[model samples]
Target: KYQRAATCLTKDREALLAFYDFPADHWDHLRTSNPIESVFVTVRHRTVRTKGALSQKTARLMVYKLVQAAAKGWRRLKGANQLPMVTEGVKFTDGVIDAKNRAA
Candidate 1:
């Protein structure tokens, strides 16, 4: 079992390693499939309350507007200020940029 587990981990090493590529402050966001799913619960409930009487296009548009409105109330990501550095190919290790990779 240990040998099999080790083999699987080695084969999937790159994906496993990707988790550490983000800054530690954003790990809570990256680690989940959808961190904002909870926020969508309200949108979903509102849609369901419409009892499917609305046309498909209307329902979609309503949901889209709901999401857009909700977005205005959302908080910014942790360490979002560092996103530009990350986007510029900065290297992070354990969530912070490696000292060697930082600009002088």
Candidate 2:
């Protein structure tokens, strides 16, 4: 009965598990929905309420201001310090860098 669902997950196992290659502190950030999506949600709500009345330039400015406002309340990444290591190609296994597979 669940064969299709099981097969789909099996097929994408590697891709789904790819997040394990990041530092443990960053795992939470990677697992959550895109941060930008939250900011856009506010813009979407406002624009929908206003219908099509906004001019193109006004819409652009509103979106920019909305995003700017949203950013003020945004939380910092959990492991901002680890970003440098990740960008440097350091490999992690189950969150922490595996001594055996350290980046050359």
Candidate 3:
């Protein structure tokens, strides 16, 4: 089991490093799936506990509203204003903008 785990980690090291691209304030959010799981929990519970069969449209609408409501309370991502710089291929190292990439 340990051998398999070590091999997997070695193979995915680059993917793991991708998380470092985000600012520190976003690390906890990136490292876990809790936020996504929480949103799905609402949909899953409603669908599973539902008594009668829902029409396709009804189920779709239910999920849509649930997700939209969930989105309402979401805070903006940290360093959101710098997102444009990121899109333009600016580089960050250890969550800080790289010295050469820093704007004057």
Candidate 4:
């Protein structure tokens, strides 16, 4: 039963372990990251409560406003400053920049 799951994980081992290539400060965020789920939870609750009362357009508008409002209270990522380094192709190993691979 678990063999398939284990095989899938083994097949994608490199990608799964790629998390460690990010900044150590971001580990917690990476581990628990689910911004879409968190943001949509309120939307789902409110929409379900409304049942069929809302038109399709109204539902979209409400979801948009809800997400906009949620964005205001969202927490910023830790080690956000390292984002540029990462984007610039900086090499990280075990959550720290690899000095040997660093560009001058």
Q: Give the clashing residue pairs of candidate 2, or none.
A: none
**Deviation in Å, model 4, residue 58 alpha carbon:** 2.3
**Residue range 1-98, candidate 1, lDDT tens digits:** 59999999999999999989888988877777563885588688888888874588898888888898888877678888888888987889988889
Error of 3 at 97 (Å): 0.6
Q: Is candidate 3 or 4 superior in TM-score?
A: 4
Per-prediction TM-score: 0.76, 0.77, 0.72, 0.75
Say which prediction, candidate 2 or candidate 4, comes out ahead on lDDT.
4
Give the per-residue Cα lDDT of candidate 1 at 63.
85
Worst 10 residues of 3 by lDDT: 22-31
Best by TM-score: 2
Give the runs in model 3 whose Cα sits over 4 Å from its true position.
1-12
Kindly report which residue pairs in candidate 3 clash with one another: none
What ranking of all candidate models by TM-score puts the best one first? 2, 1, 4, 3
* Local distance difference test values of all predictions, in order: 0.83, 0.85, 0.79, 0.86
Model 2 — which ten-residue stretch has the worst lDDT?
95-104
Error of 3 at 30 (Å): 1.1
TM-score of 2: 0.77
Model 4 lDDT per residue over 1-104, tens place: 79999999999999999999888988988887588788889788877887754588987888899899889988889999998988988889999989876655
| Clashing residue pairs in candidate 1 (N, C-alpha, C atoms within 3 angstroms) | 24-95
Could you tally the backbone clashes for each prediction? 1, 0, 0, 0
Candidate 2 C-alpha lDDT tens digits along 69-102: 8899988988888888889888889998888656
